[model samples]
Structures are given as structure tokens and as C-alpha cells.
Target: MDEIVTFGGRVTLGQDRQADDTERFLEMVGDRVRAARNRRSISRKTLSEISGVSQRYLAQLESGTGNISILLLRRVAEALDHKIEWLVGEEDPYTSDAVAMMSLYRQATGEQRMRVLEILDPDNPHLRRSRRLAFIGLRGAGKSTIGRLAADRLKLPFLELNEEIEQASGMPVNEVIALYGQEGYRRLEKQSVERIAATYDSIVLAVAGGIVSEPETFNYLLRHYHTIWLKARPEEHMGRVRAQGDERPMAGNPAAMDELRNILMSREALYARAEAQIDTSGRGLPETLDAVLDLIEKRGFLRA
Candidate 1:
């Protein structure tokens, strides 16, 4: 008979539960290792050689009796060309398409991975937005200038989303913002995106920098059109806008540059979700335009 000790009537039970949970987790890890090896048609001896873990240890591991160290498990995972988390994850790697897709996505080239993402996106299911390219960035990334140039060179229609919104509302963007408020403006923005998707199959589009702040609308844009993020330093962004005679960004705000940098930092991850990116910092307008065009052509962004 074994003596059980309890502290406050809970310790013994808690210990039992924790032990059982740990045993189950170890069994799961063992099962995954065995399954992965079997799927690859690798023998225990061969796995041992590849992973540098002894055959006896591999046997014990597969039998759920070996409490392998994390470093050793990592080596085995690498030998199997699988992520360690896949083996230890709650989802069964053998059955989960998500795990498989993640593995494939990790192994895929940038272009192929983007295609996989596009196909898997649940947001928009109608075929690819044919021959449509969108340039997205902050105010001074040269979206309008580069976008128009690329469109003309590619012989496609060029449309700026803000202009479309103004045309649709029959008012300037400032008036729309002033009268309807930010939320109202966002509603109009979403509608304009839908209209453009329906209207054009071959066009270069430029959109407001803040579009990425709205997840649904941004996801829709990503689903429909091939997107490119144009990047620039905060100073360059302010300088370019000022060069265009729009002093609103720095007119009275002493901290405008800091705010701009903060905005870029915060939205950096969201902007990176684009399929392609172009950094225009320190580049001449023509050089940036050529780079964007080259990327589009190289990536076959407009190909149906």
C-alpha cells in the first residue's frame, strides 16, 4: 500500500492530475514522432543516425517511455524536417491541414507562399483580381506619381481611391470627413473599394495610407488585387508632401515627424502583409517608378 499525503485536502489530488497530464503529453509526443518517422518510411536505426539520438533512446521515445530533453527533441525534429511544435502541439500534425500548410508555406519561395496565402484566404473567393495592381503606403511614398507612371507604361487605367470617393460623394474628401466624421468616411471608403473591384479588371490603383487600419477593407483589398507596399523614411514622407505644397502635416504640429514615425512603426506589420514591397527611400522618382514596374513585371502581378 502506498501512503498518500495531502496538503489542505488538495495537494495529493493536484499532484495526481499534474502527473497524468504530463504522461499524456509525453505519449502524444511519442506517437507524433513514430507517425512522422513511419510516414517518411524511415527506420529507427536510420532516424537515430540522422538525429544523433541513439536507437535505444529513439525506441524508448517512440514507446512513450523516454523523457527526452528539449534539445534532443529539437534535433529529432530537425532531422525529420518538421517543426518541434508540430510534434508537441495539441493539433495532430498527421491530420491537421493547418500544420501541413504552415510547413509548406515555410518551405515555399516568397512568390509561391503568396499564392498559397491568396488561395487559402477566406475573405474573397472569386478568382484572382486580374490585371489589377494597388500601391499602398503613407502619404508621401509616391503612390500617385509611381502608380500613374507604371499604369501609363503598362497601358492600364490609373485611379486614385480618394478621387473615386470624392467623385462618388460629389464632395471633396475634406468636406466628406468634416460633415460625415471618420466612421462615415470609412464606410464610403469601403464602398469605393467594392465599386472599383467590380468596375476594373486592369488598373493601377493608389489608396490612402490609413486603409490598412481597417482590417475588413484591407483584407478585401488583399484578396482582390495584387498589392505593393511603398516604404519611405518619415523625413522623406514629410519632405515629399511639403514639396507638393501640402503643409498640413507640419504646419503647426511640432511633433508631426515623431507622430509620422510612430504611425509607420505601428502599421509596419500590417503593411508588410502585402505580397510585394518597394522601398523608395533616397531614390529618384524615376528610379522608384522603374523599381515598382520591374517588381510588377517580375512578379507577374497583372497576369491572368
Candidate 2:
């Protein structure tokens, strides 16, 4: 004999079809809540005690014989560490960030945030085009410039790994080394490269000139993606670097120029692991780009 007020008007439970629909919806919600409780291995008595709803009332709701107030639903959901919408057979709201690419989702009301997550919960995450492009040479090489341009050409993202590590640590690269020491910087650099590699697909990586110091990361790149070695003459490198006033590479050594040459000579084996080598001596942007493109085609990266 109880009357339920619906959107259209007052409805008596036995006489109104719309009231029947509401009853069906309520039954479904109660069934869902019972299932959730069972999934967590909670019995009705435990749930009733913990939620402070009487065991008989809780049983009536589970058996589709009792009405649930909004307040009761809220209390039950909170006791279960979930949202009331979840207990009421509505979608979970915690998954909104997964579908940030949706235009309407971006503009949706704050209340719709949970609804968005429920929508995207069943799909795969987005893919990213990222890669690693290491510039191998002594100081003054065109790694940053050429790497950026190549990234632009391929329509891929770019990063100076050294700069990323420095920014992430909030200190200069040398200062990090001076403070945390050499092994610490290498650890940071390795973690950064691995994290980027796993997250992105097409990227131009600009590694430090000394990344060959860690052979593990070097070998991993060679095994996984196309590696490009940007090479130039020692004199050309020194000229380019000195023009930019980066004197650290040349300081405290009488034969710093020869030392650079010797350094390249020592790492030549590692550099040779690159899929393609570009000798940047006297080569401007166009010629160097053409050379790289030709190599990319030859390596079967881009088909005819």
C-alpha cells in the first residue's frame, strides 16, 4: 500500500507500471550490491553490523523486498570503500583520466568524471611515438641541433636525455655527478632512458656524448631500435663547441684536443653498433638530412 513518488507523479506500487520499472531497477541495484559484498567475502550479518543497517533491513534489500534510501546507499558504499553509484549498479567513476583524449570528456562536468572512467575502463591505453637518437662524439658535436631536426622530420618527439635527467633532479648534470658521484648519474640516466623507451614509440633521443660509458643501455638500444651515430672530426667538434663557449671539455689538459681524438678512438667499437653513421664534417643541415634519409630508406625503415 506504500506510495512512491516518481518523476511523472505519485505512483502506487501495485497500480502503476512506472512504479514497477522503479521496483525492477531497485532490485537490480540490490542484487549488484549483494554480489559485490559476496565478492569481498562479506556475509550479510557482517555487512549489516559494519554498515549499521539492521540485518533484517539489509536482507530485505538483498532479497528485493525492501526500499533503500539515498542516505542508506551512501552509508553502505562508504563502509565498503566505494562510491554509491558503484553499489547501485552504476559505473565506477575513478577511471576518467584514461579517456582524456575525448573532446566531450575534457569539457564534461566534474560530476561526469567517474562516468568517463567507467566508459574507458574496458579499452587499451593510447600509444606514443618515441625513440632514442644518440649523438656520439667529443664535446661540441651537433647532437642537440641535428637530433631536434631529425625528430621534427620524422614527426616524432625529441628529448635531450641529459637535460631531462638534470631537470628531473633539479640540478646541473655535473653538479649531480659531483654530489651524488659518477655511478649515481649513470643510474639516473639509465632509468630515464628506460622509462622513456617504454612509454613512447617514435622519438629522437639525444643522449650525452658519453653514454657509451654504460654499455648495457647502449646494447639495449642497438637490439631494440635504429641507432644513429652523429660523428665529426675532432677539429670540427672543438671549433663548434669553442664557438659556443663550453670550455669544460678543454680545461685542465695540455693535450685536450688529442685527448678527445683518443676518446673517440676508444669508443669507436661502440659507435659502430649504430645502424647508420653520419660524418658531419663540412655537412650542413640539408646534406646531412639527405644522408640520414637515404640511410633510413636503405635500412628499410621507410619502404619505396
Candidate 3:
């Protein structure tokens, strides 16, 4: 004797449940296929011509009455410029925006992918109004000088990121670097930024010049702060470093100028991703400050 199942006092057979599940699956597949076709503005006749599937078969598929083989479904998916998994509801529905994002993601390198993920991450802090403004650029690009002055004028707190890192580790940055190496420094850098982002609502941050080299940390900063790239000519960078009484720019490395140029060249693209930029070359501190203030005003970054 076959056992019968009762739901709500109604007897149900196992075959009945299997049949219902199959029907639901078919309906879901049909709905997704129709949606994908409509989103592309593709007609069944056009799809049939491209995919070599019959118009009648496509119509049946959309109506949830036809069974489709994997081979035929692949052909239809290719014609609609969608993945098979997307058409079959195995993945999220494909919108034009999602399609474009996926295409860009596929083409991005690992570091670039980290930056992209920051933008796409749902929990990104900067998705809301960011309270911090970060200045990014090579050393001697006026990030410290201009960022501090901007913070004063804006009546916000100013923080140098390296100092923050040192404080967090209870050691100077150079010592931290010497003990932990570059990878360890980057890990600490990320932790420090996370802490600062959580603690401050409105602040000005001066970041290290090589921060961009660590994509994960840099991406987090991009998402949590209003970033501005402080730009300067290579000669100006060296001269300004020297002016600050820091001979480290030329100390121990005779090819320091060439090295500086190479570093700038490599980081130009990453820095350009900042929300805004100010060229500090040939500009006085007051003039540069005014430029940054003007940008802030224009962007409505400061909350009333």
C-alpha cells in the first residue's frame, strides 16, 4: 500500500507534490526568459533568427508550456546577450546597469577590482554624507599644509594618518615599518582608517603619499571620505620636501629625482580617481586654501 500524505485534512500523493514543484520551476524559468528578452527589446522572431530556435518554441517557453534543453537555452541566452544562469534564474536578473558593471569587473585587474568593490559594496560608509575630507598626493604636494589650514577654516578636526597609525601601534611609523614590513604597515593602515572613520563625523585627513599603492585601504578611504588629490610638478615636489628641511628626498639615493618622477607617473591614474583635485604648484598657501574651500562650497560638502 502506498502511503498518502494529508495537509489540512486533504490527502496528497507524492507524485502530486513533484508535479507542482515542476510546474513552479517551469513558470519561474518562463518568467525570467520573457523578462530578459523584453529588457533587450528583442522580439521572438529576431531571437529565433539569431539563436536558430524556432519562434513557436520560444513562444511556448515564455508561456511555460515548453521544456527546453540546455543546448537550446544556451543559444537563446547568447542571443539575448545574457548568461545562461541569469536567464534560468540561477543568478540575479540582468539589468543593463548590472551587465555593464559585470563587464567592467571582468576587465579589471585585482587591485582595480578592490577599488570597484568599494564603490559597489552596499555598506560603504560614504554612501551617506561623509564627514571627513582626505587629501591624497605624493609627499610635498601640500596635503599636510593645505589640509590643516582647510580644517582650521572649516572648523573641523585635522588628522595626519601616519600619526594616527603610529599612535595606534604605540611606535613611530618608521619603526612599525621596520618591524612589520610593507604588508604589516598596510594592515595597520587599514585598521587606523576604520577607527578614524568610526570616531569622527567631520574632519580633515592628510594621508600618506603611498596609500594608493594599497588598494584595499585606499578604497576604504575613498568610500568613507571626500578625497582631494593635491597635485604639483615633480620639481616642485622635490623642492618642497627640501624646503621642509627633509633631506630624505635626496638622502642616500642619488637617483631620487628620477625615482620621484617614476612614482608620480605610476600613481597618477589612482590619484585622479579622487573626487576633486587642486594643483598647488605656483600657488601660495592662502590661494590653495581658497581653492579647496571653493571646491567644498561648490560640492556642498559641509553640513549646515
Candidate 4:
């Protein structure tokens, strides 16, 4: 058969098919970008500001009339707090119910999806199954100290969630955040928690303070772990950070303490959702450790 002249020049059937496939892929990407932005209620202007891409270009991309570089598209995906693979229709290795919910939300239309979201509780009781004990709290809440001591006394392995995240990403937490932003960091955090849950039968995990900010990840933690909130005052948190030679907590912020207080206040309710609480405020290290040990014994978390 003779090749057809699809354009000004003669083109093979294979070439025409390839061109069609490329166009279809671009259109799919555009649709996904628009859907994700809509799901997040993010305007083009907001995405442009966060992604450093021009608003005009974003509009064009969404409309499937613009050609975008992979790097630029990655910036947009990161800004939307979505993985580029998800946006581009690639399978995620770490798929879960929560991840599926996120995908469904992105792919659904308005109003009905909002109602669906409202009905789906991230912390539903059906999801709860205690396998390990996890300590949650503000930055200086003695999660590391108390958790480690309790784990040692009980003959359980102790792991810090932040350290795990750093290990998984092969970089410091600060670097992960710098390279991938908070959204990227949270994604890694969720994956790390999942990996830990599957790898360890019984362990003591000290979760990141801001893990609560991501509902799906936090809910997963709550479901798979016997969670305990380790509470401490804002002053103690600041003091501990300072003692560790991390002055960034108080650097260049006159209202740092106030900000810390506000964060604790905002997250109080979330922290309280833990199965147990240990208030470490104004207590010595030994006393705090004792309290944690006692709480674990009393609550029967070791066998949980």
C-alpha cells in the first residue's frame, strides 16, 4: 500500500499513528491537570505563583493548547501536591485506599464529589488495627526520649519517623522539603510509615509533629498503630530545640513562642485523637520516662 499524504508532506501510516498518540497523551495530561487543580480549588494564578510558571502558560496547558517541558509540568504537579506520575496516568507503587480516594476526588466532578468527601471519614473505626505503638506530639514533647526509653525497657525496636523519612529519601528532612516542598515531603512520610508498618511486627515509632496536617497519612498511622500523644508546654519545646543547638526555632522571629503556642493550640484536637496521652510538662526526664512506661503497661499496648 502507498503511504498517505496526511499533511503537506507524505507520511507513513506509522508516523501518523505516532503523532495521534502524542496528541492524545498531551490531551490526557491537560485534562488531568485541570481536574487536579479543580479538586484542590486552586486557581491558575495560585498555581503559577507556587510553580513559578506564568499564568498564561498554565491556562494554555489546561486547555491542551500549550507544549510544556517535563520540568515545568513537575513544578505544577508539586505545587498541586500531586505526584507527576499520578497526573500523567502512571501506576503508583504505594497505592492505598487513601491514595485511591485522592485519585477519585481528582477525577470526579463537583457537588457529588464534595458530598462523597464529606461522608468519607479518614479516622473511621473500621480502619483501626493496632500493630505497633506510635508517639505523637509537638516538636519538644519528649517523643524521642520517652519513646526510646520505653521501647528499650520493653525490648522493642525504637524508630524516629523523621529519621526514617530522611533515610528513605536519602537526604535530610530540610533537603527533602527544599527539593520537593511540603507536599512532596508528606508523600514520602506516608510511604515511610507504610513501609515501617509492613516491615516491623512490633516497634516504637516516634512520628513527626506535623504528620497530623496530612489527614490520610495521619489516619493511616492511627489505624495501624497504638497512638499516644506526648504533651509538653511551648516553653519546654523551645528549650529543648535550643538545647539541641537548633536555634532556628527562635531565629528572626520575635513572636516565635506565640507561633509555637498557636501551632500547639491548632493541633491539640488532632493530637488528642491518640489512644492515650502522656503530659510531660514540668516533669524531669526520669519521671516522664516512667510515666510512658506505666502508660504502655496499663494500656496493654505491647500486645496490641
Per-prediction TM-score: 0.60, 0.54, 0.59, 0.57
User: Clash pairs of candidate 2?
Assistant: 93-114, 95-117, 96-117, 129-202, 130-201, 130-202, 130-203, 131-203, 133-205
What clash pairs does model 4 have?
none
What are the lDDT figures for the candidates, one per model? 0.90, 0.73, 0.86, 0.85
Backbone clash tally (model 1): 0
Best by TM-score: 1
Judging by lDDT against the true structure, name the best candidate: 1
> Candidate 3: where is the Cα deviation over 4 Å?
1-129
Question: Where in model 4 is the C-alpha error above 4 Å?
Answer: 1-131
lDDT string for model 4 (127-237, tens) is 244348899999988888888988889898999999999989899999999999999999999999999989886889999899998999999888888899999889999
Q: What's the lDDT for candidate 4?
A: 0.85
- What is the Å distance of residue 284 in model 1 from its true position? 0.3
Total clashing pairs for each candidate:
0, 9, 0, 0
Error of 4 at 237 (Å): 1.3
Each model's Cα RMSD: 9.6, 19.8, 15.4, 21.8
Q: Distance (Å) between predicted and true CA of 48, model 1?
A: 50
Q: Write candidate 2's Cα lDDT for 103-186 as tens digits.
A: 466687754744565465633121111134445555566778877887788787878888889887999999999999989899
- The TM-score of candidate 4 is 0.57
